[model samples]
Target chain A: MADGVAAHSERKKTGNVVEIGFTGDDAALVRALENGHPGAPAALFDRHAPHVRRMLVRLLGHDQELADLLHEVFARALKNIAQLREPARLRQWLVGVAVHTARGHIRARTRRRWLRLASDETMPEPAAPGIDPAAVEAMRCTYAVLQKLPADQRIAFALRFIAGLELKDVAEAAGVSLATIKRRLARAEKRFVALARREPPLEPWLAASTRWRDLRDDDDGGDGGEAAR
Target chain B: MTGGLQALGRVAGETAEAVAEPRAEREIAAARERLVGAREGTVALGRELATSQDQLLAYPGDDTLARARQRLLAGRRRAAGLPGFVRLAVPLAVCLLIAVAIIFGLRAREPQRAATATAVSYLVGTRAGTLGERVSAFAPRLGAAPAPELRFSDGSTVDLERASSARVTALDARGAEVDLERGAARVFVNPRRITRWTLHAGPFTVHVVGTRFRLAWDASTKRFSLQMTKGKVRVEGPTIGERQLVAGQRLDVDLSQRVSRAQTAAAKAQPSARPLAAQGASGRRHRRPVRPARQRLARTTRARRFERVEPMPAATPAPAPATATPAPAPAPARPTTLARALQHVGAGRFCQANGLLDDKALSATLAKAPAKALLALGDAARYCSAQQRARTIYLALWRRFARSPSAAAAALALARLSHTKGASALQLQQAERWLQRVSAANGASAAQQRIAAARRVELAFARRQTRRACALAREFLARWSAGSAARYVKQVAVRCKLTPERKRR
Candidate 1:
């Protein structure tokens, strides 16, 4: 039985693990990269690249754009790996990079729109295949709503709700004060809830969702019934 | 509930029907797995980058660190410039800088300051209006300039001019400390950090750690009043002689003469009774202290009394004892004013609710009732043209119940009103100011969220991004259609051209 297990593991290694160079702990990988071990960096990239790409895809709503951005993120990460003080935090470091890359893309896109001739047509919807149609539609709606928010608030909302990063992580990644992040998050959530409530078809979803309802209820109670809907 | 369940079931059925084929299910599962993998990868990367940034930021003055810092800052700037990015970036940045700064800066500075052999001395004074050229000369000496005109989150101000010769040690995230050599200096501790504003007066060291507390240290008489408006403070050393100050209490550290027994007795007496006496001396009626558990019961009673339902005259004719009183008419089934007010508000009859509140009568009634009732009334009167009345109620509430949730609510409302007619920039500024106050008092998450949303609206408006503002306005309206501020949302929507009638759905 031991022989059989060993044989199976060896075969698996031959097929998958051999494609990349050395595979071990994250620290080992970092050490390898430090030593300029061939293909060692690629192994690290293989482990983390897909996740970064997905984040970009979700944030930008375009796979091709995400793919391009993913390449840049890896290249930058690889170049700066030696400078990474804590190899253990490589994941957070990469995500932060992805967030910034996504932001740059969005900014460039917005700037381009401003430079071009004005069009009456609405934003073009992205094609997402084989996903839950409702979830995709909701995301699209959310994206449209997000475009209406100020840049700071939108980023805060994305980091907090969409990305589900902790308040501390979000603040650190964004390089703002905790208070500023709090202020932005507070406003963004309020605006998001308010906007979500205003959409006719989306109203039920907002009201029915416990999270949404709680946000509305909290805001309503605090403001002395001033803006409660 | 059954209907809701049925609707849910139908939706689920439709979703299932759409993916009936095994091939479709397999495809969906694969797609979902891929998405999950992707999401995990993104999160991992984000975490890794954040960690790396943290490590870099934590490095002890690494020159290469500046490049990483600039990258992070650039990313922040870009994110800040992106619509709806504040939610993600603001907190991340804030926590990174302030929290880390507070933790590390305090640790690094504490030992250095404590080890210093010479006390740095300078003159401290306040200047009104612009902080002029002389300001730079005076800046090093002044520990903290608390302008009375400048209201901070802590609700107290320090008059720097009052303490002319105070020495400053260090200024970090926690706040500044001063070595008080002569005369009295008053310091109000802000709530953001657990700041120990230590005033090292001769023979007396007063430490104010949190909230709106005033510490006055006098050199000649050696008298200090640590008046705690909110939160608590602990005073130690020979000057205080083992005394602690709680909220709404004042500890007078008097050393003019030998420590008198009478003053000690007065200080030891029930703290709340002093406020009661002050209230009585001002010709205001006082109510018996209801049990704290029954505090809500008192509010309900006061709310009922405000309704003014006429009591039935005593039974004139004597019938059988049990039947004569007519079962006391079940206490006349008085309708609670809060319920009535809420009803009127729900029906869009804000004017009626305002009328019921009788803003004029509130001053006398509020003096006797719990501050919460007045706060509620002020909130109700916000929509009415009675701005003065609303302002009065809020101010009174703030003064009487400064630390209460109601006070914060009133302050926020008043601040909002003050900003309404101002320019967009002014409004944004005011909103930011109010948000700071709200955040300090540990505001409700919902209130914070609304502030966030309003900020976005204000930001978009300021940038002349009318289309984006309109879109946001529409979302706000949709989410808060039944919210109390729905009308305000509607108004903003109309202004932004987000109204359904103005733009195609």
Candidate 2:
């Protein structure tokens, strides 16, 4: 379905399907989904899958299970839509659910890695097909730095920098107070920048923060899609 | 955080998505197709949940009540979306129904099991209407109508006749102590495992270990009766004092102050009272004091011999002195070999029992002995696989004492022998009849009914009666999960397979 819409977008040379947001009010859409209208969840999926998938990929870094994660996120949303009190913030609530799911996956993976330490093997870094070697090395070093950080810090840094979410949005997704996110980000940024300084491939990224921020704004429309900042 | 990976992502993030691969697209497409094709989402959720998903994504759709709540939530959402006036009317209707339900629910009180504790109100073989007292309480009162029955967890059952009531004051591994308030009850105690039981029936208290017997008490009439169908019971009361009631003997307590003679099938049979005792296969001794006998009533008319009927109240104020027929006094207990043998068998010392019965000194005693000695000898011989001896003993007991409890057991034993090689169809028919009558056998005589039931199922299966065998097998499993023939029953069930053709009722 995502491919169908991407293909359609290609034919038209227009934006992705998510850009054509469902027209109904969030409250009405939630009620319709709760009512088991069938079409409502499909519409919700169409409206949110690309956004959720994009955010998950950014946070997890080339997550191979992006498809399953997207299904899980939307299935949860569809299931719990009735419990959503603030219909106007449906997108924000969805982000909270997605953050929880991602954290669980991270924790489970950490446990698995700990259990399998006798094998003395880690998952090999995914081989990208056509990416620049320099950019790939920098990205690889970024994940390595993130891996050393606690789960909360990793999530805060991914949301604030990789996904380009504001500090308030980061707090919302992490289901924590704004103060907590601020503290996490402050602590994470100090560790992240210090760690990045040790990686030779990330030297260029630290030197051009302003230019990089500009590139991010040009690519993203302040929502989940391919983003730069 | 932003200055580190955030800056790095701002620097190199574009590369990850820039190289979006075919495999990733294919993976995403597979998930999308599954999501699209999912019809029963709850079923998919159930299947998915076995692999521990995060709590946030896990749905509680598996539980019936939870699914109901989901449907209710959807209904509520739909109702909320309706116009304000419509929503107002729905809540009012719901409130009225709730009020009505509470009102009606209070009027029809239901027996509620104490879920948190084993202190529950359990009624079986009868209903609440049959009870003379309240059925449900923090502590339940179990009662029954004529021939009231009580079932214990260890597969032993008790039946009370003529409007009986009893309270299980305490229950534990040693078995239970029942305080029978009134009337009569026969206990079909499980003898396979040793268990001590005491019955407090009015003035008389009967103590027993693993046995079958009947005890009855009437406060108004000052009448107490104790009959040991199998095993031994010691009865204690004011009138009868303390005397052990052996198998095939009836001790009755009348209005008279002194103990009377216990009724026996053979007039010349010796009176034997032996406390129940057993030695384990390892030669370990176990003993439980038996209840004393109340002595038997005088011989009545042949028509009313088995059943004891209450005399109609005298209508006239002045009545002539009752013409009581005096029976000959009972002979003193003789320490004969035959009496000792019967006592040994009743106490489960079967080797000594059979050995004594084998002696030439007791040959004359066995020839004309009562049902007590006959049943004991039959049991002793049968235990030792002396089929010919058992048949002779059981046949005599069955013929001379048809109404006695021993007769039923003897007939069933004969039924077993009748199934032997080269048996006539008439003999098999007689065995089947005995098995069926085992169902009708009341109180103490019904001890072997469970084994008889299992044997019936085994017989059906052996005869290749597929449908009948399947039905009996199913019934047997439901009735007794681990009955005597549980392995045979399970085998029959597997053989039958509950096929649609077999289940064509």
Candidate 3:
């Protein structure tokens, strides 16, 4: 994947035969889409679809339904492209749509309580042999607890903590006010902490919550990629 | 603990990427090919699905394929048949656009209904300091009998009577304020969409709600009189008290006890109380409207009812603080949780401020508080080390009330937060954007704008754009000179050696 991305080194000059990724600011691509340029939508799919897919999958852990959700997300995006008043916020908007889609998945799971959810069987493939077992178990334990949360709370928690969206963006994606998002977060955090306490595999994480700010990785500037001027 | 949460999220994200995301990519590729193929006349849209039990065993998405197939079949049938939804796609899309155009088009014209009235933007004097320079306050000398006309952007007029002068102290999206010094002033606040226009006349404050009124202060007589010939005005003063006067009514300031109506204003004031048209007013230059006419009345233009002299008044008359918690009445039933938090923030009692703000009850006001309240909340969150919350609240205040002074302050706060620790190039650019917003705000104080400009020089220095930094530092130092911002900018220039030590003799 790194090599694939490396092949496209930021489109140095205009009118070059750019690769799958448009390698230009989102605004230019949006303008092309508005003009009905055929390649622009494909470029948008290549640029944003990966991130959108990643966000939805992370929020709705190991769901086979991801493909349907993916089609719905892009179909809706294509249909509503012009509805976006600010094209510069394309990434945020796409991620918002993914989060909304994830919420729908969670709601469905909530309603289908009787369906035997194939949980642990579908966890991601194991890391290389040298990887820490505790970290692997921590990941498993984290999802185990997340599956219990209400849809709104789970979405808020995922967007706020997992995706690391700013509170404003999270509130926007969830279509709720900032205060309401905070309220939801407070409840979710409280429940998550209470649940994590019972899982011994998550003991370190539970303890780390007390000093989470101290141990977190340095913010080498979040992927807050530049917006169009 | 926050770090732990972040770690958990990283692990969760990576795991999902390793499993679900890969699956997602493969599926999307498959779906895209089918959809695009159907559109481009390549492969047939979709193949028939197997039985449900076979589908469950063979593929993860038999249902999704069925749905897509049905859609494709519908499209194919439409293409071959007389008419269908797909056949009508172009016309349907055009109709949708036309409907959207109609909705927003009507919305575009909504402001013009208010356009029938005009509001003052600038009060220019014939001999004013510099003609056409936008200044916050205008104090014009009484040169002629009519004095100089207050010329709004729309070219509407107001005149300070002879021997009278007024200084416009502040003008904001909400309203305008002018300090009436020493004599009477005839104000023609043309039917304005803005809710409030206030003139601080001597001992009294005359609040105009889109009306023509005359407020006279007899300095020698030590008396103030408010005559409302059109619309209504609420007058408040120390001894004169507060009184609401409607059209055809007059209130006289009796230094003895309270504001009292002297008499019903006679018919003489009513007939002549006509709203002054730009063309009718004498000596008024009828310049073309400064802004496009259609764009003129787009802003909310809500006449914010006079929010008493002091913002955040302590005494809210509501007896029950619990039931009415949602509304942060301009006044509060109790010493506001926000006010107390602000005090705590000032006193550096960060824990207490944080505690107060974190209360479940206080969250109600967090959403709807005025810009000033939001500022204090942002400050409290910042001091408590809740950087994310602080940034969110500051950004909200900046976005919702961009025309207020608090918004500019929020911009500066966000800029400062951005550069806190090893800020990235993108973060620095974001800071630059915030500073630009501050410098651009018409409502921001001169001091705040100057500080923001100086900070930009500092950002340049931090980015190692030494040449640019030095030049900006020199410019900043020259402009700010003795101001608080000058010292840092001067140091930056001197350190960068952009400004050399005095040439050796």
Write down the lDDT of every candidate, Cα atoms only.
0.48, 0.52, 0.55
Candidate 2 chain A has its poorest 10 consecutive residues by lDDT at A220-229
Instruction: Report the poorest 10 consecutive residues by lDDT, candidate 1 chain B.
Output: B310-319
- For B314-362, candidate 1 gives per-residue lDDT tens digits of 0011011111212211111233554455444433344565776554445
Worst 10 residues of 3 chain B by lDDT: B41-50
> What TM value does model 3 have?
0.28
Stretches of candidate 2 exceeding 4 Å from the true structure: A1-23, A117-130, A207-229, B1-505
Position B285, candidate 2: lDDT:
26
Candidate 3 lDDT over residue span B325-400, tens digit each: 2333432423477666655544445456667765453545555677666776676566456778778878888877
- Model 2 chain B is weakest, by summed lDDT over 10 consecutive residues, at B312-321
Quote the lDDT for B492 in model 3. Answer: 61
Off by over 4 Å in 1: A1-20, A117-130, A210-229, B1-505
Question: What C-alpha lDDT does candidate 1 achieve relative to the native structure?
Answer: 0.48
Q: What is the interface RMSD of candidate 2, in Å?
A: 18.2
Off by over 4 Å in 3: A1-23, A115-131, A211-229, B1-505
Q: Which candidate is the best by TM-score?
A: 1
